[model samples]
Target: MHRSAETSLEDQAVDIRIQMIQLGWDTLTSVPKSRAGERSVTLDEATTRVLQEWRTRQNKERLAAGPDWNESGLVFTHPDGTGLRPSWVSEEFARIAARAGLPPIRLHDLRHGAASLSLAAGVDVKVVSAELGHSTTAFTQDTYQSVFPRVAREAAEATAGLLSGDAARQA
Candidate 1:
């Protein structure tokens, strides 16, 4: 989701309005790839507080930049308020992850992880699919859902428990 520079901190939701795509040397902002991509994502309280602090810091940078500030209306930007290139973000994420001793993972892997984790945490698939901007829950389940061993075992146990309860009730 893209946050506008003018977005009020009072609201903890960001609308997914625009997408930035890189072509050659230029980065262009345009409508999202699909209609489903246009949605709102609500921030948790902790994330909302962090963004509030980041905005304060960014405002200070904007003041320091003076006439040089680009006014790009992005939540994250360079000191001069210009947007960062997507490729640069991905490469930097890799470097940071390596420095933190994490297993080598592409930045996009986080999306898959979020989907899988959300499912494992018992969040509804439809809600997770919507957050991911997937057109359909079937596609989301087919593509992003990974059945972890523990989650699989928990599911089996829960089903057996339900069956046991049914037998007891009948008796």
Candidate 2:
């Protein structure tokens, strides 16, 4: 089960408890699209520190808003603590990416990049699949994981070394 954002932040993790979707004129909070989507993602040290700073800033915003604060209990929110629209967030991301001179990419492409990087870094496919909330490793591999040229070359070299008994000698 997912804990409150406050509690999860203390643990340096973000629990995927709910999803917020904008439907035409209304915004709705609902369960995730799949069972696997309701999982926890642990943060690295830098990310945890950044979130801690953001939380402190958010608290100040809440105090400034006083009675006007919405208390949505979400990690990301507007100055008055209301949820941001998903479409707006995507548009903002695109603008930010463009300002950085990055090639055009949808915000969702970050997930694919993360998955590919994890696989290239030698993380187990099952673990990467779980992190991505993928139903199966095969789907994760087929859709997100790419054989980075460096990683493929390393695998080829390792296989050749093993066949020539050079791997044992190196070990």
Candidate 3:
């Protein structure tokens, strides 16, 4: 989600924009692969509030930094306001996980977990794919189908019910 849109949503709508990222030496660039990667996602209320609070905190830090701030305007940034290095982010995640006594997991794995959660919550596959910046819905389905077996089974059963003229009424 871009910072401006996130802070401006008075009705609690959230938009995710996968427009830029730190890929190798290039710190930021347009969507990585295709147009599908650039999209807006609606966030649940809890996530929206968390982001709003995070922005507020960031603003406080910006004020404290004053002239020292780099003003990169990224949601995640270094203490001096520059973009955070990807490796540093991963290492910090590992350190925090260890401190919390949690099992080890790569930072990237969180993206997969988010996809699974969205699918399990009955969000449409295409929407999840877009939010994940997937090149195609097929890839999203193929990758995540195994993680959301129950939802997939329910989908199959719903299709069967449709054939039996029952799903329409349920819908």
Per-residue alpha-carbon lDDT of candidate 1 for residues 29-122, written as tens digits (9 for 90 to 100): 8898899988877667898899889889999999999999998889889999999998888889999999999999998899899889998888
Best by TM-score: 2
- Name the lDDT value of residue 15 in candidate 3: 48
Identify the leading candidate in terms of lDDT.
1
Candidate 2 Cα misplacement greater than 4 A, ranges:
1-7, 165-171
- lDDT for 171 in candidate 2 is 73
What is the lDDT of every predicted structure here? 0.86, 0.83, 0.72
lDDT of 2 by residue, 45-81 (tens): 8988987897899899999999999987877888998
Clash tally for model 2: 0
Listed in order, each prediction's TM-score against the native is 0.89, 0.90, 0.71
- Model 3 misplaced stretches (Cα beyond 4 Å): 1-30, 147-171
Candidate 3's displacement at residue 142, Å, is 0.6
Checking candidate 2 for backbone clashes, the offending pairs are none
| Per-residue lDDT value at 31 in model 3 | 44
Clashes of each: 0, 0, 1
What TM-score quantifies how close candidate 2 is to the native fold?
0.90
**Model 2, CA-based lDDT:** 0.83
Flag the better candidate by TM-score, 1 or 2: 2
